[model samples]
Target chain A: MSLTNDRIKQRLIEKFGEPVSGFEELYGLLSFEAPKEMNLKILQFLFDDDELKFRFLTDLCAVNYPDDKGRELAVVYHLHNLVDNIRLRFKVFTNVQEPDVFTASKLFSSANWMERETYDFFGVNFIGHPNLKRILNVDEMDYFPLRKEYPLEDQTRIDKDDAMFGRGGTIV
Target chain B: MSEHQHHIKLPEGSIEKQTTTLNLGPTHPATHGVFQNILELDGERIVSSEQTVGYIHRAFEKLAERRPLYQITPITDRLNYCSSPLNNMGWHITCEKLLNIQTPKRVDYLRVIIMELARIADHLICNSIVGVDAGAFTGFVYVMEYRELIYEIYEEVCGSRLTTNIGRIGGFERNFSNTAFEKLEKFLREYPKVLKEFENLFTRNRIFMDRLVGTGAISAERALNYGFTGPNLRAAGVDYDVRVHAPYSSYQDFDFIVPVGNTGDNYDRFLVRNEEMWQSLSIIEQAYRKVQEFKGADAEVFHANVPEYYLPEKKEVYTKMEALIWHFKIIMGETAIPKGEVYNAVEGANGELGFYLISDGGRTPYRLHFRRPCFIYYQAYGELTKGAMLSDAIITMSSLNLIAGELDA
Candidate 1:
């Protein structure tokens, strides 16, 4: 029961109108790049299509395509269909200045944390996410740790002056 | 306004109270890691619990970028140290897929043997930690003792119990030691008895049930939605397992049951894991049989495409000049690894442990992402712990079986 890549591509194209430019299909993984504007609608199609009911939102993450000329930030979503057991991937290419994509947190509540994580590290903001706070980093942390611009070596020093774990930082 | 540690419950605050804050950890023993959780409490119940990670972040992903795929096995050691072999093997497999390396059948069997051992070791620790959190001190010690025995087998096989750099690009760096197999046979014989003891002690006990029943209950709908894998998702009645749902590392040949739970409660999750340990033992038994069955067969000979990545054999290096030069080249990691991206998910003891590696025609991977099970489970932590009692929080969190190493990594 090996699922070939061609089957997923044919189904996806038939469901959502022609994908944005630079859509490529690999072995068993499907990847398509959509402009930041059309991400919500394409996601809606994926959720609505009976054949490709990607009910299970497996993973929502972002990667910085720093060197890519046309766009800078690529927000990739690795979604899986629970009933069919096929995986589909869709990404949005947004510029570095305003890395905003509509939040799919309403569709999958788990997206709430992942979006916050993407925001914390890559500075990609989910437009309508209810609580978009830094997940991996502290509240006071100003920089996103996962971004390429951020220093590779963490500069936050552990303080030894407080009674409640440390001094400089209030236990939060 | 709470005063002393005793009766530390929140004062008469309204559910609508916006400013009431509750500090959960960093110093608290509940948070297993050197981690902190701050909660905005609303009268004895949590309004919001915000987790602050990077307290134990060691820049592992960044460190992987500096080394070749072979050398990065040690760094994977820290990601899931409880199941370092699983992490080590996962990294190697992903690199192999990118380089299109096919390992020998004997090596595949060897891989299964070690992975099953690591799985049992990891599950033992995870289940015992649940006991530790539940105040069953004696159970934790017993489980740890058995885990130490598993470590003994690991030590004999790879010379290190924690960070086992066993697999090369194409095959294992060396043959399995005879002493290790003998030790494993003895351990397998006794492990079931100890596991039965564990089930007798905690799985059916009323006190344990009180702490776990209905605590941290997540429905199948919610579990699947959050990318929850492994026991957490299975506990919610989802039969999906990476080994079965998506097989890798010759897992297709092996037969194992994907246990599912009904309620998604702490107890059900515990049941799933307990049964899972029993299942893991069976898997190891079968894996061992396969190892014995395929002893001298030349099942595979396809070397990984990145020739400069794998270390050459001792005989080859001593006799052949090209092999000697290749060994030196591999030492420097001056290999032209292809520009490819692959995502490999392994059914680790705790959950679905996946590695997303994007190599850019270089020796080292350009980007490496870990689809950690604990992280996914912890995302639902607030929903899991919201109205449950403080004791339930400890037990339920334990039942979720989230290792802090995997969570933070």
Candidate 2:
């Protein structure tokens, strides 16, 4: 039989136990979250496993949740098992203040730039990344732009009102 | 010798610096896009190269978080402008997937035709540009006419050309006009002959073959590890096409081959793209035939029946109350979006263009990340070009089809 979500979940539960939580299949994609420190360990397990040959690193990015205090940032990895034709999402949450997650670049070389991009946008500060500098944004940039704290529009602009724009008002 | 040394008293470290550091581009014509490669070279051979991108970083993902569903299509268009329709379609499909909207058969087939045309246009540019990089400009000049014909077909479907904001959230903004079908028919009747001629010009040409055959080759293993997808992966002999593996927009209904090459070199990439153009043509023909088989009312169906997201007719909006309210709600971005996360990918001209969208029942996405294939695989450029000749690096970059906008976005 082809690798199903239950089977993958079973394997992860077998290996990582209860720490691998929030298993849900939405829009046919199986998603689960793990502890921030176990990111590389899980990635390596997924790569080294015989049955779960999720070799292709489809995408890597970060999502910011300003309200989720202890876990303010989520680094999402989209891994594809080309042989079984299954895709899964693995996420690890970290606090914004110390957002240091182990890098996956050692396992997947493509993750080098992606991790850099994540660091640039969300300030993930991937630990042990070979060149963990900004990939897309300029180096002189101070704050992470994609974080929810940073609004898309300029705060200093006096002409436009945020209330009229329909997103809750910050306009004078 | 002592008198000559005294006459030209060189700096202490001048003779020890054996390699030259050359900046390939941020604006060089040969680089094709706004990308810079700082190459450490030993004479004409590259020692090690470092690439610096993000010249056109438009903060698209950040912008996407604020825009509603329909407004994001134009942002996708700028991702891979060479085949903007494909990007537009990919984004719309992502939205549709999140909303759980089912499209009609005619709309699916219509999408297939436009998307296949886009694939052909994209492959034409990459392959012909490969020829140009290899110093064969005639093929580029010849194939561009057909690309223009393809553009005319796009013009008939959508109003614009290059960065075409083509399709809507669920389907096309309008139906395919007769002129569009005629233009497609004209292209179909004429393009095969031109493609054959293009192939004849480059496939076996001694100079073109020599420049591309073995240079800049990446093994299938490395290509996958480096996240290579679409033609670049196919060129390395892995037939992992998004259209074939995960069929979308009625792609499973059509019959087409996923053409692959053996070596993963510049020549293989060129050949793979060229063969894919042929496959795209065949797929377009099948979709067109399937579209024609739709009888009566089915023929007129273009967009899906999702009034909540899709806009009503302008005349109806002006005349009727409900249409006006719906129109206003959609324009004002007040439509209720479902709370979910969905990832949708399409076989773009170069690679797999994926949209990872997360919506928290908000007007805009909670977080939206574009899995631009160019950006993912472009990290391999340093490895791909290491120890190769400077000119071959140019060929490899063009063969890789790295779009700067997509890369930096």
TM-scores for chain A, candidates in order?
0.79, 0.92
Global local distance difference test of model 1: 0.74
lDDT per residue for candidate 2 within B255-354, as digits (tens), equals 8888899999999999998888898899999999999998898888899988889888899999999999999999888876889999999999889999
Name the best candidate (by DockQ). Answer: 2
Cα lDDT of model 1 by residue, B1-409, tens digit: 4455566555566544675677777757776665566776656666667666656766566566656677888877877788888888887887777777777666666787788788878777777788788888777877787788888877886678777765677766656677878888988888888888888899878887877787789999888777788888898999988787777777887878888998998888878888888777887888778777753544333233345667887899999998999987777666656888777778877777778777766666766777777777687887888876666776766677766677666
Among residues 3 or more apart in sequence or in different chains, the pairs in candidate 1 whose N, CA or C atoms overlap within 3 Å are A162-A166, A162-A167
Q: Rate residue A135 of model 2 by lDDT.
A: 78
Give the TM-score of each candidate.
Answer: 0.88, 0.97
Error of 1 at A33 (Å): 1.7
